[model samples]
Structure formats: C-alpha cells, structure tokens
Target: MPDTPLDLAHLRAFHAVVQAGGFSAAARRLHRTQSAVSHAVRKLETSAKVRLLDRRGREVRLTEAGRRLLSACDLAFATLDAAQEELGQERGRAEGRIRVGATVEFGCSVLMRHIQPFLAAHPGLEMDFHLGHDLLTPLLREEVDLAIDCHDHARADLERTPLFRESYMVACSPGYLASHAIREPEDLARCTVLSLDKAGAWWERFLARFPRTRRPAFGRVVAIDHIRALITAAASGMGVLLAPSYSLQEELARGELVPLFPSIRPHEDRFALYQKTARARLAKHRLLKAYLEALNPAELGA
Candidate 1:
C-alpha cells in the first residue's frame, strides 16, 4: 500500500531493537554490528516515512506508529515461525522440545507428577519446564510455548482453556485438632493460621464464604513461604492450613492431617492453559496439549 515496500530484515532489526531495549543488545541478538542494526532501523523508518522510535542515549522508546508496526511484526513473525515449525515437524518424527511455564506449586506438585508418564510415552519429546509466579509475561513474549496461569485477565491474543479448578481444604494435624476446638468457622479465630503470607490470603479466601459479620479474626499468623514447608509445619501441629487438596492428598490419606470444615466448601481457584493464538502447529504442541487436557487433577492426587 505504501510507495516503498518495507524490508523484512529492517523491520526485524527494529523489532529486535525494541525487544532488547537498545541497539547494542539488538545487534548482539541479531548477530549484526551495532551500526548495521541502527542503519536497518533507520532504513525502516525512512521506508515508512515516520519516526518509529524516540532515541535518548542508550534507551529507545517506540513512537505511536512504531507500537502499531511492532504489533503487526509480532503476528507476522509468530505466524511465519509456526509455519516453519509445522513444516519441520512434517519432515520428522513426532519429537521436539516444548517450553512450559507454570506456577511453582502447580509445577512441582501437579504438573511434574503428571508429566512423568507423558515423557515416558514419548521418549523423543523433551520438556523445558519453567516454574515461576508470573508465567504470562514469558508466554506473551514467546519465551514459552504454553503456560498454566491462574489469572482471570482476558487476553484476546491468547488461546485460554479451563484446565482445572484447584480446590482448597482447611486442615490441621490430629494433635492440633485434639488440643484446640475448631467446631465452627468462628473457632478459627482462636487458633493459629498457617499461610504463605502474614496477611493470611489463603485463609481469607476460605473465610470469604462466610458472612462478613461471621468472619473470624486470626489469633496468630505463621507465614511459611514454601508450600512443602507450610505442609510440614501444619503436619507438626503448628497451625491450621488452608491448602490445595491435591498437595495434601498423601497427608489426608495417611491420617497425618484431618479436615476442619467437612460440610463447608472451601475456595476453588480456576487455572487455565494458555498458548498464543495460532502460534504453533507443531506436533509437539498438539501432543502436549492433548496429554494435558486428558489429565484429571483429582486422579493425579490419587
């Protein structure tokens, strides 16, 4: 549509510059000289007849026009990459690397347990598991092929499928239950609340089900950052813990931990599997997708 056709290489240089945050970094990533990368970006701006970037020393900020072009370039590059991967897969066996992003607890407790059989069934497939708290960023940046996120934010550019709902259970060790009375929801106020944070976020969600007037105040809060450590603390009769049911299956089954509220349903957090919309058509992606979709969290606990 324009008088001059924008060069793909130049556009790539501009994109890399923006992604890397500077010309020097972009040059290193593109395997080109800094001057060369700068020239390519300048050429791209000339072709478009607009200033796409605002350069201030080492820092570069994208202009309004650059933001629009970058979005288009991202889509074009992702589509092209997907097509290339699809073609490569067609010429080879069903084997490749799948970069997966997931939360720490879910990755350790749930995903790792399920991925064993999947890896065994497909020996040729390799899994690059990236465990973190913010998986959405890496997923959007294409650093990860897929992500399992618990966020409720809507992203039109992503393909989100409800993978599972992680339900919570209020539990404590048998000794603690015997020593302290937790007959009703209000009784929780008199007991120590075990959580990952002093704010008692986990217990807050469980208590949200009760009426505002009936909500119990915590007598003491013990914050343990790690899930396993928190579980161990709760198992030692330290305090009451509201944890995901899947993570507490063994303890509950072995009678190491006992449920507090049997009749009241605790909070359930919905987690969804996310992938870039039409990003990859590779067989590895499909295989992992099908395998993950078929898994039942309840069965995993068993």
Candidate 2:
C-alpha cells in the first residue's frame, strides 16, 4: 500500500484512547461512538504501519512505539493548548487547571487564604491543591503544576525561582516555658527538641545559624513527619519546637505557645519549582506563579 498521510483526527483519537485507557472512555471524552474511536486508532496504526496498543488481560497497554508516539503527541497537544490559552488571555480571558503542591505549613498559613481571592478573580479557572511533606517529588513526577519548597537543589532539568524568605521560630507551651524557667534562648538547651523529620535540610540550615555555645541543648529529639504534629506537641509543653512563624501564628495569638529567643531566630529561603520544559511554557504556568507571588508576605498583608 502507498504510504498513508498523517491525520490530526487520527492523532487526536489515538491520544484520547491512550489517555482514557479504553475505547469507550475515549469515545465519551471525544463525544464519539466506540466504533468511530476504534476506527480512528486503526487508521492511525495503518498510517504509521505499527501496532500501537497491546491487550494485557482486561487492560490495554501502550506498545513501545505507542509510548514514544504518545509522548510526542502529548507535547504537541500541550503546546497547542497553551497557545490557545495564551490567545484567550490576550483576548482578556484566562483558563486551565493549576495544580499546586505545597508543604503543610505553607499550605495552611499562606496558600489557603489566597486561593479564594484567586478563584474569584479567575472565574472559570480550576485549581487543585496537593499538600505533601515534600514538594520536590510531586513537581518531578508532573503530579503538580508547581511546588512551593524551602530550598533549591541543583537540578539541570528543573527551574527554581526564589519566592520569599521566612524565619523559623522556637516555640513552646506557655506552661512549659513558665515551668522550666526558660527566660532566655540559651535556656532551651535544657529542654527536649521536637522536630519535623521531613524538614531535613531546612531544619539543619535553621540550626546552623545558632552560635555554638548558645545552641539549644539536644535532649530527647523526637521526629515527626508533619509540622502540625510538632506544633501540637509543643503546645502540650512536651518540648520546644522550631517552626515557620506563620504556621504557629494562631497558636501564638491564643497564648498557647511563646516564641523562644526571638533574637536568635533563623531565616529560610523559599522557592517555587517547575520542570524546565514547563517553565519554557510560561503562558501555561504564569497564572499560578502570579497567584503565588501575590501571596508573598510583602505583596500580601501577611
């Protein structure tokens, strides 16, 4: 047979099928019948002269050729979608989903407040928030459109922009502070230190800022994965815990916890992360970045 020519409809159908994982699902997505969808895929395979999918038990799997073609098709579709969004934006409209991943502390303290206003401003835009202990994994896996993280590591395929700076404060139950006679920063050395273990590097950076002799005495070090749990432990007077100021703002206002050694607080750098490929497609990512930038302490009232 003569070499078949490429067809956008065939490509679209194949992409829909691959993404939806079934002919019926793809048909529903494209508003076409299952037979029409199957015929489109057959035409695509005929054009390419290759089997694109394999039957694996009850599921359909992409053949190696299919996987490669699907990747290219995804990139092409993403570019087209981004271009369309840019045109819409130029015409005074914005659209598309913004998936954001954030650390627990940042999510509750900063992110939660801004989301409402952002949605109000962009009526049709969709937002998905994923709160995780680590921001890097989600960004790397394409699980989130963007991530707010505490530090930037060197990664050739990732791009990071410094968003803001925040300080760590040592806080403990008012009762604990009063009972322990901890009137100064140095007195913290005598108490247990509650730490969020997942905050590994950030926690170390915070500690590095302390003077050798004045560093808090390391007693029983308890590590938990969640920042809120650390805050809860500190509120119960179990130990002195270091955390971002915003995360414990409410507790501090309630007089449940007191900032330990305000003078010795350490500052941490905050960054926004996205894959280099995603960064190059800024029009697609700009709204999320703009939303986050507005939430920065200097921009927002904090």
Candidate 3:
C-alpha cells in the first residue's frame, strides 16, 4: 500500500474504465476527457505501486490487481450510493435512482405500464430501466438493483418474489387468420411464422405443448429479433406470432390481433422479482417491491 491515501476520484475513474470497457468510453460515461480519465487511472496505479490495467490501443484488460480493486470499488461505491439515497429519503422524498432489469417483452408491455404511474407519483425518484432477453448476468454482476425475469433458480445470494405465471398464445391479425385456412396445427406449416430466432424454437415449443403424433414444421420462419417488432409484423398480417399473453393484451383488446386455438395454451413461465440478498433490505428496493406485489393480476392482463 501507498504511504498516503489514494484519491477517491482516481479510484472512481479506474472503476469506470473497466465498467465501460475503454478509456474513451469511460470518459464519455464520466463526462470527462479521455486524457483526464487515462491520467486518473495512471494516478491510481502510481498510488497503488502496481499496474492495474494492460492497455492495447483502444482496448484494455484488467490485471489481477485491477480485478481485486474493481471488486472493492463496487462495494464501496454501492455503500456510498446507498448512504446518499438514505440521506435523501430522510429528507422526506422518495429520491434516488432504481436500476431495474427486465425481459424486453415484459419491459415494453406490463412492467412499463405499471411503473409509469409509480414514477409519476414519486416525482423525486429516478429510474434506469434496462431491457434485455437475459437479465441474470446483470443481476449477478450487480449492474441492476433488482430484476423481473423468468429465472427460477433458487440461489442463496438472491431473494425472489414470484410475480405471476406467463402463458403464450398463437396470434395473428384477423384478416390474416381469415385469408389463411389455419384450422389445425398442420395448417401452420403453410403459413409464415414470425419468430425471434430463425430456428423457430418458440413455435417448436408451442407446438410441443399439443399432444399430436407429429409436429407441424414451420415452412418459412421470418426472424424478427424483437418481440415488439414480431407483434407489429403479425398485426400487419405479415405472419403468425407465438407471443406471451401479457404482451398481446393491448392488441387483443383493440381487435388488431386475434388469438388462434384459444384452447391450446403454451407452457406457463413463472416470472419473479429478484434482488441480491445483500441489498434486499434497502428502503428503495423495499418500496418498489411492495408496489409491484400490490399490483392486480387482472389489471396486468398476464
């Protein structure tokens, strides 16, 4: 260790560099110049008397000391952020930002719908809503305060609150359904299937739910990377979609999309709100947790 104390600003710069992947990106994230960010990291290394990062042009790789220091920085920064939030809360406002991770479909539909009102009510509070298909990585890396996802693992480090079971249905525009004679599962082979993947994995799973001797193969799979885009394509009569019921509520209600084979429901996915066991007791997390738990299932349309 250095004889004198290391500057907190230098440490923060080092952490930001690793988090943002490069000096230039870190500078942008910290609202500082690239040279300034690089200088701070160099200062931090000089103070520690060890090289923390191995720089290669625009890329950077963390040395062993860098990895260790980054972990310490995460804990220290989180504690300070929590303290600041607590101080703000003590001043009688629901202040501080909540980082939320959610699946793209749910984030765009159900979660977004409910959280809007909550955020509107709490004028002082801010939120960072991150939507992705895989939320487990962000949760594990502590990039998110909490996550609403279909991850069902019973990990000791996590506290999970079961939200609801998500069901899927086959959807298409009414005109498309009428134009194409899709009376049975076999008829789906004749229709274009809108899928997130070109492999038509979702359609395969949905078809597996049916107790048929032979599964219908999707003739043409139109791969739309986003659920929202897939829904839009299905609404435009471009193809048939296999989507979660929660995401289809608005379109179904508006008669823009119609469900095919209402009797055949795909497997239900259990979505839960997950928080790190270490931060589960935080006041901001507790407030958001309670608000979500209090939501009506019928209102969510899941």
Candidate 4:
C-alpha cells in the first residue's frame, strides 16, 4: 500500500482532543464545530492506520499508540516555540559584541566615561576595550570594530570622525611652579619634563611646532611608558607635563597641577573614532556614534 501523508493540522486537532479530554471540549478550545474536530481526529487516525482514542469511556482516553505519538508531537511544537522566542530576543536592538581599540589616554578618559550609558541602554550588547600600544594596527587589520585615538591619515578603506576639541598646555604641580619660573614655553627647557614612553607622538608633534620664541631650544625630557604614571609623576612635581587640558581638568580643579603659558594654547586634534567605510552602515557602528555624540559639550569641549 502507498504511504499516507501526515498533515500537521490533523495532528494538531487530534492532540487538542487528547489534551482537552473530549471532542466537544477540543472544539470549544479550537473555536471549531464539534463535527469538524471529530473529522480531524478521524483523518489523523485513518492516516496512521490505528484506533487512537478510547471514546467508549465517560471521558475519552488515549490508546497506547496515541500516547507514544503525542509525545513526538509535543517535542516538535516545543522546538518551534523555543526558536521563535530566541528570534524575538534578537529583534529590534543593537545586540552584538563591540571590540574597540583605544589609546591609553582615550581608554581612561572619553571611552570609559561614555561606555556605561550605552551598556545600560543596550542590555544585549557586549564590549572589549583594547588599550595596548599601537591599537591602530589592529583596527586596520580588522581585529577591532572601532579605533579611538588622535586624528591621523586613514587608508582609503577607512573613515574617521573627530570626537572632540583638544589642546596641549604645560602643567606642573603647584609646589614646583611656586619655585620655578615658566613665564614662556622656552622656559620648559630649564625644567624637568615628564612625557609618555618614547615621549609619545603628541609630545613630539607639539615640540616640532612650538615657536622658537615661545618654545624651549633644548628641553630636559623624562620619558614614561605609561600615561597614568606620567600623570602621577607630574602631580608629584617630577617635571613639567605637556598634556591635553581636558584630561587634566580634575587635577587642575583639585589644585594638583597648574597650567603655564595660559595665553599660549597650542590646539591639537582630538581623539577620533575610526572604522572601515564598509561597516559605516552597520547598526552597532551607528549606535556607538549616536551615544558618543550625546556627551556633554561643556565637559568634552567638542
């Protein structure tokens, strides 16, 4: 004999009758007439070539075959329901991992300050902050979703957006300045200068651009490999630190460090967010930009 096809509708109606204990009750639950429900169960049993329900009892009871097949039907419908629930959880939100590459300074300042609000808003989102040296290398290699660092040339495949406005100023602890006279930028050459390891790219650029009139002809340089250590040294009166004004706001406010040549501000590029142009349209990238842009302009001076 040829095999009969199984219709899910017939199987569903049969399962409903078994679960509801009677054809009339199942019809009520399914919003169908009693005859329609009985026909569906009959079709299912005919296809299976077996008697499924013991209808002679006061309440219908499942046959042994019905009990076995009902287990299979329950498993199938349960799997479908679970898949739908998972899909619903993934819908309508930025739900994915963001691997961000940031310079040491940016990781401590802008990145740290902005991350909490975004995470609170998107419970399904995840992030990893790579604060290691030369983060731009990983960004260009596609290892990170975004890069946060000083403005620089990007390859044709990449795009950059400036995050804020920044400038460099000479600063030292109040105790150091009380004794040393730093009326001009050139005066820095006479004072001990603390800077990041290899003197960092920012300090190098600042020195090359400083005017012969205002800048030191030859400055005493102490290179620290860490930004936090550099900040600590400057606070301890180790030397004059040429640093971004915004990053030192807390120190300045608390009188831990004092700025010199307040009138002579050398503006510099703020940290920028960089990503491949191909990823510009992605929801995660757009969401990150939206949150970062909402930062307080007064505090960030963007």
10 residues in a row with least lDDT, candidate 3: 293-302
Give the TM-score of each candidate: 0.84, 0.71, 0.84, 0.64
Pairs with backbone N, CA or C atoms under 3 Å apart (clashes), candidate 2: 189-217
Using TM-score as the measure, what is the rank order of every candidate, best first? 3, 1, 2, 4
What lDDT would each prediction earn against the true structure? 0.84, 0.74, 0.84, 0.75
lDDT of 2: 0.74
RMSD of each: 3.2, 5.3, 3.2, 19.5
**Global lDDT for candidate 3?**
0.84
For lDDT, the strongest prediction is: 3
Q: Per-residue lDDT tens digits of candidate 1, residues 1-302?
A: 74899999999999888877789988987899999999999999999999999999998998999999988997888777767666766766556678999988888888887789989988777889899878887776566889988776588778887778877888999999989977887787789999999888767768888898878788899999888899999998999998888788889889999998888877778888888775645567778888877888653343
Ranking by lDDT: 3, 1, 4, 2
Colliding pairs, model 1: none
Candidate 1: worst 10 consecutive residues by lDDT? 293-302
lDDT per residue as tens, model 2, 119-155? 8888768889998777776665455777777767578
User: What is the TM-score (0 to 1) of candidate 3?
Assistant: 0.84
* Candidate no. 2 TM-score: 0.71
TM-score of 1: 0.84
Off by over 4 Å in 1: 1-10, 16-43, 55-61, 120-124, 278-283, 299-302
Residue 37, candidate 4: Cα error in Å is 57
What tens-digit string does per-residue lDDT give for candidate 4 at 204-264? 6466666656556546778887777888899999988877666788888899999877776
- Residue 89 lDDT, candidate 3, scale 0-100: 84
Backbone clash tally (model 3): 0
* Candidate 3 structure quality by residue, lDDT tens digits, 1-113: 43757899999999888877789878887999999999999998988889999999898999999988887887687678778878888888878778999999878777877
